[model samples]
Target: MKIIDQNYINGEFKTIDSSKRLTLKNPTTEEDIAQIYLSTPAEMDEAIHCAATTFESFSQTSIDTRMDILQRIHDELHKYEEELIDLAVLEFGATITTTRRRTKNAINLFLAIKEELKSYDFIKKDDYSITIKEGVGVIGVIIPWNANLAHLCSNIAPAIALGCTLVIKPSEFNALETQAFLECLHRANIPKGVVNVVHGTGEVVGEILTKHPLVNAISFIGSTKTGKRIFENCSKTIKRMTLELGGKSPTVLLEDANLAEVIPHVLSSAYSNSGQACHAGSRLLVPKAKVNEVKRLLLETIQKLKIGDPKNEETKIGPMINQTQFNTVQDYIKSGIEEGAQLLCGGLGRVQEFEKGYFVKPTVFICQDQTLKIVQEEIFGPVLCVLPYESEQEALNMANDTLFGLSAYVFSSDETKAYEFAKQIRSGRVLINTAASKAKNPPFGGMKQSGLGRMGGRYSMDAFCEIKSILF
Candidate 1:
């Protein structure tokens, strides 16, 4: 078994002194694969101090110097691409295809941020005064287990570009993968104390990062509940925060949309990352007249998805992260049945072939009630709720009814109509007909309770910066 007993602090990995150890199992085989010694409160404090100390010099780095660091980090990560992919599959049961795509995207974020920094203006001068942007000092990053590396790189890229230091707290479930990522950073020769990682439960490491006064800002990617708690905790220090929280995203199929072409896109959004994504289009909105056709297409498409082994190239869906997640998915499935929603396909229980593991059946339900728990809550599993609407306005209303406004999808043959409808949905990103964005550096974040601030491109640069006005 892989034993991870160190925390990456300052310029080196230090052995953790805490006796608290977390054993991680392969979600696919239910076999122990790694054990990690959790970081104690004292260790977390040391990491924060290191970052804070480094910020005094790191924050003054030139743009060209920071860009060079970003490039080097990107290259180092690429060297470990295959190892990271393997760890992702073994540690969290992610399919190889999904792992490769996410890993590539995560690595590319650094290059993208480097490109953004090339032409970025740090200071703007006018006849009266000059406005300058400087790094916001030490940043605290809290990442979730679903896409831990992606979140890590995404948050780190911007901090590096803006010459800010970081103290990261990654989820304990993916220790091996996190360790591999830290090794890459170490090999890249990043400046001492510029980036540090602490491994532990949220109650210990996460709380310290959020409440510490030395941490000037925070960037978090997790559930809304945790985000709210962090928000409350950060209030004590009045830290600048950029929160990328939960989502119950909607996929709306217009009357003019071709069901054959659109059903695949809908399923891709709904079930991507085994439906464990914050931005998964878990709520499907369809016209009342076409519910039958949509149902037929959905049932037909779900059968073709392979759900056994995550390492297999053919597997599109994989097991839940652990028994707790598996039980949560099962509970949601039970609620769907007890609430009187029609089970369109895939009921409770694991796939018949798997006697062990945390695999869950890809379930779907047809329901019109918007208040049902299955329809309203964020079930982070391969389960979808289909809601039928009478008119376009009703569809818009239904899509925006939830507490989340992270992402929304609109499908229509008429581009103008889809674009118009997308504008009305209250979300950070609204994709017309594609599962992924075609834009190179589109800003990403949510409105309302979904999040507090944005990340990506110039928005990320701004989030990690503090502005000052100098009088002429």
Candidate 2:
């Protein structure tokens, strides 16, 4: 098994005081693939203080210098993209196709932030008022196992581009992927202590990093409950925070929607990363009149989604990150049955041909009540709960009922109606008439529990910044 015992601190990979390390299981093989260091509280403190010190200079660095660092990071990451891709597949239990797509998308954000940074004028010396968008000092960047690469890249690249330092706590499940990427940062010769990567359980190191005094802000991507705890902790110092939290987002299927195209898109959005995304369209709300039709499509769609070894190019689905997640998904499936939701297809247990790994069959539940516990919660798995609504207003209410409003989808032939529906829905991003996801251009975030602020494009850069005005 490969073991990584160093945490990137003060611009270099260094070992901790003790030999304490964390061994993470390969979700696919159900065995240990690697071991990563778990930082002692003192080492975490040292990392934070170092980042705070670096921020003094980093926050004041010229945009050109920061831009150069970001450019180098982009270049180096591209060079190691293949290896990173492999690591993501291993740690992610995601198909190589999804791994490549997400990894490339993440690396692209470095370049994207470079362009976005140009739009952020750090030192404007106008007569009216000198307004500057500056970094928010040291940031604690926390990521989840699912979408590990994309989330961290989106948060950290923007911080570096905005001239802020970050202490990253990658999910223990994929420390290698995070380490490999940090290797690129180190090779970029980034300023000392500007970026540090640590690994451990959230209760141990993550708790310390989130509450550290030297940490100025927290940019977290995880469950809503954990986000709330982190938010409350940061409250002590009133540190600025940006959290991408939970989602029970819905995908509305209007009768006129194209079942062929829209079904695939909705399924992809619902099942990608095993539905672990904050934007997972876990709820499928269809018009009551077209209930049977939508159900047929969803049933057929979930059946066709090849779920198994992520290494297989033909595989469209894979296992949850670990057993805890697999069990969580299993319990939700059980609850769906206990709650009396109609089980159209899939339940507990592994895929037929592949039984050793921690895999769950892609489960779908058709329910009567939109308020059904299964319908209202974010089940981060391949489970999709199909719900039928009597009218458009009912569908809209069901979609907006949850505290999470991260993402939603509307399938309709009429563009105007789809646009109008999107306007009424309280979500960060809305897919219209298709399952295809959008790019990093427009603003993305949630209205309620889904998250805060937008990521990608200029919005992410905006999140890492603070605006100040100086009157001449």
Candidate 3:
């Protein structure tokens, strides 16, 4: 198989003119995997121009034609399932199980979006009034390294279904995976200039796409800080923006909840994707009476999780994206210790056996209260802060205390109580006795500083569209 080293523009794979390139390395083995040719200023402009020009024709394309293209893309995605999984494992240090599941999920997400398009109403008429929903125009998508494939599909599928053209800026860390995705689109015979991928630093290529007058909308998935910058650039042109930013999501366990059953779900929610997820349940709010029992159960479960080589099928936890991410996580651990949070288990540095990879232990800390840094900050790692609350109202308050309202969870034997509590929670999506990730294609996003707008299913199509009313 030939490694794809060029940028996709105008339905063609063109060589990047820049001497600079991004060298990708496997986080698990610390070995070089592939290289992505960095986009030159001219190449970046070409992509934006291609997409802006394509939108004129693409935005008028018939719904059936767009739907067929989506189906084709869906079929094309599965054809490279194994290859995608391998790339994810190598470049992302994703465990075999996680890579397989997330890859399959990413492929199926297109199919789900296709199904949504079938019932979605692009044009509606009632008596003398006509309402139309159309694509927002040329969209610039910036996806993060964590869950890159699924996140890309979440944005791109809807953009295409709504008859919009796009230029994607994938995380440099997972350039190979993004290249595979572009190849899938190319194989699907997507119309030329409809979808393009550019590789380079966010400061350059990202800034260009966001600030370009030709680009009409921006869909960004990354940290809150970066999202704000993107928002500022988009605001200059008053462009449409969809941002899925950071989260310090909380998981609240009620006093009546059984610690044994809920602890496993809590642990999985916090540690999945090695806790690199934006909506990770990093803060665990437990009843004060059950803190000791929760700690004991958490210890037992953490011991069972295998943390090592991502190639191993049994590995549940994998390394951070790179050394910088590893050090960031370690620094957060140090801060938790310094701030007087009790280290219940697992703390600091690499796992003893693995001296080569950027791995960190599945750490747990018992915070003195919600005021602690570990409880308040978005530590995107496998570090869980257990905060004990005195009452249900207090738990709800603690969960809503942060600036991030991305996701929240409540576990209780009583569904009514859980549902009632979930309603008042400040997050965009609330899970009752379940992890925050199980809802597929339902409305997903956040409130407050978690960023504006939503994604998933019909909500996604609506987000990418502009509504107009014609009164007759």
* Highest TM-score model number: 1
Clashing residue pair totals per candidate (backbone < 3 A) = 0, 1, 0
Local accuracy by lDDT, each model: 0.93, 0.83, 0.88
Which residue pairs show collisions in model 1? none
**Which candidate comes out best when scored by lDDT?**
1
Model 1 ranges off by over 4 Å: none
Q: Between the candidate structures 2 and 3, which one is better when assessed by TM-score?
A: 3
Per-model TM-score, in order, reads: 0.99, 0.96, 0.97
Across 135-233, the per-residue lDDT of candidate 1 in tens digits comes to 999999999999988989988999999889999999999899999999999999999999999999899889999999999999999889999999999
Q: Provide C-alpha RMSD values for all models, in order.
A: 0.9, 1.6, 1.4
Local accuracy of candidate 2 as per-residue lDDT tens digits, 136-253: 8899989888888788788878888888898988887888788888888888787888888876778888889888888888988889999889988999888888888888878988
For residue 359, give model 1's deviation from the true position in Å.
Answer: 0.8
Quickly count the clashes in candidate 2: 1
lDDT at 118, model 1: 90
What lDDT is reached at residue 310 by model 1? 96
